[model samples]
Target chain A: MKAKIHVYLKPGVLDPQGAAVAGALHNMGYDEVASVRQGKLIELDLTGDDVEAARVRVDEMCAKLLSNPVIESYSIELE
Target chain B: MKAKIHVYLKPGVLDPQGAAVAGALHNMGYDEVASVRQGKLIELDLTGDDVEAARVRVDEMCAKLLSNPVIESYSIELE
Candidate 1:
């Protein structure tokens, strides 16, 4: 089984990297770009096939180590 | 309109960050996790509502700056 975790900065958190990207885009003549936000996608391949159990475990993984609860939020997808 | 780009390392490229995260997960008792790959998600808010044009521009962004074409690949999503 595989678990995909999408971790993103929470709304209202300042993202300097995203800002930098936006600025670079503008400089490159992409003036149509209004805003940018950057996040992370983590794909984990696991040993077990049990979807429910995998979700439970991966959720714990996200909470404990994959994301910073203070400023980032994460979603999980199982396959 | 909005565009989302998902950029990932090419399959043969080594990802140290992913390896570190996998090791951390193992240390945190997630022994079932076999492999991990980390990627980036970039969301762009654009001025035009034309999805096709937005896609074209964002794809150029990915090619020119957002991703390293030699070792990474990117997928674009318009919204």
Candidate 2:
């Protein structure tokens, strides 16, 4: 199975990297840009017989490894 | 108009950041994880009269500001 995972910082977490990228955009004449947030996309191939069980495992991965529980969240999709 | 933008490192780029995160995942018992790539999701509100024209402008923004053309790529969707 092929899946795409997204990990993002939760709202209220200070994202200095995102802020810096947004600032760069504005400075580069992208005045139409209102805001910029940075996240992660993990695309992977899984050798799994059951997608439901695999999803559970992937979620566990998110909780235990893929994201920082204190500041980040994640979502996954079977593609 | 509301739009969501995604910026990602181009294939073959050295993604040390992604490698670091993937290594962390493996260490945390996420053996199912095959790979990890980091990217950006930028959501914004645009004050535009024409969406078609706005899309072109946004593409320019991606090229000139939102992404580093040498190693990154971007996509945008009007929401």
Candidate 3:
């Protein structure tokens, strides 16, 4: 099974790295681009009974390791 | 309108940051975690008539700026 997980800073959280990237983009001349927030995408290949199991394991992984529960949130999509 | 963009390093591209995160996970006791790849997720609140045009601009932004086209790929999901 394969999956993609997206982890992001919660709304209202400060993301300096994201701000830096946005500044770079504007400097590169993409003026319409207003703000940027950077997050993480994790793709994994797993051996599982099916997508459900993969989803379960992935959810656990995200909760336990992939994200910081204090200030980040994550969602997963299976493919 | 709102959307999420995920940018990832192409397969076979080395991602030392991802490696570092994976190592952190392992140190924090996730032995099932073997390897990790880090990517970027950007969320935007936009002014647009529909998702399609937003998609176009977003794709262009990703291609020209958000990601390095030479060694990366990206996808977007709207909600």
Which is better, 2 or 3, measured by TM-score? 2
Winner by TM-score: 1
List model 2 lDDT by residue over B1-79, tens digit each: 8778888899999888778877877787766767767777777667766899888888887787677999998889986
Q: What tens digits encode model 3's per-residue C-alpha lDDT throughout A16-44?
A: 98788778767876555667777887876
For model 2, how does the per-residue alpha-carbon lDDT over A1-79 read when each residue is reduced to its tens digit? 8768888889999988778877877787777767667777776667766899888888887787767999998899986
C-alpha root-mean-square deviation, each candidate: 0.6, 2.3, 3.3
What TM-score between 0 and 1 does chain B of candidate 2 receive? 0.92
DockQ of 3: 0.44
The residue-by-residue lDDT of candidate 1 on A1-79, one tens digit each, is 8889999999999999999999999999999999999999999999978899888899999999999999999999998
Best by DockQ: 1
Compared with the true structure, what per-residue lDDT tens digits does model 1 show for residues B33-79? 99999999999989978888777888899999999999999999887
| Residue pairs in collision within model 1 | none
Better of 2 and 3 by DockQ: 2
After superposition, candidate 2 runs with Cα above 4 Å error: none
For candidate 3, the per-residue lDDT at B26 reads 68
Winning model by lDDT:
1
lDDT of each: 0.94, 0.79, 0.77
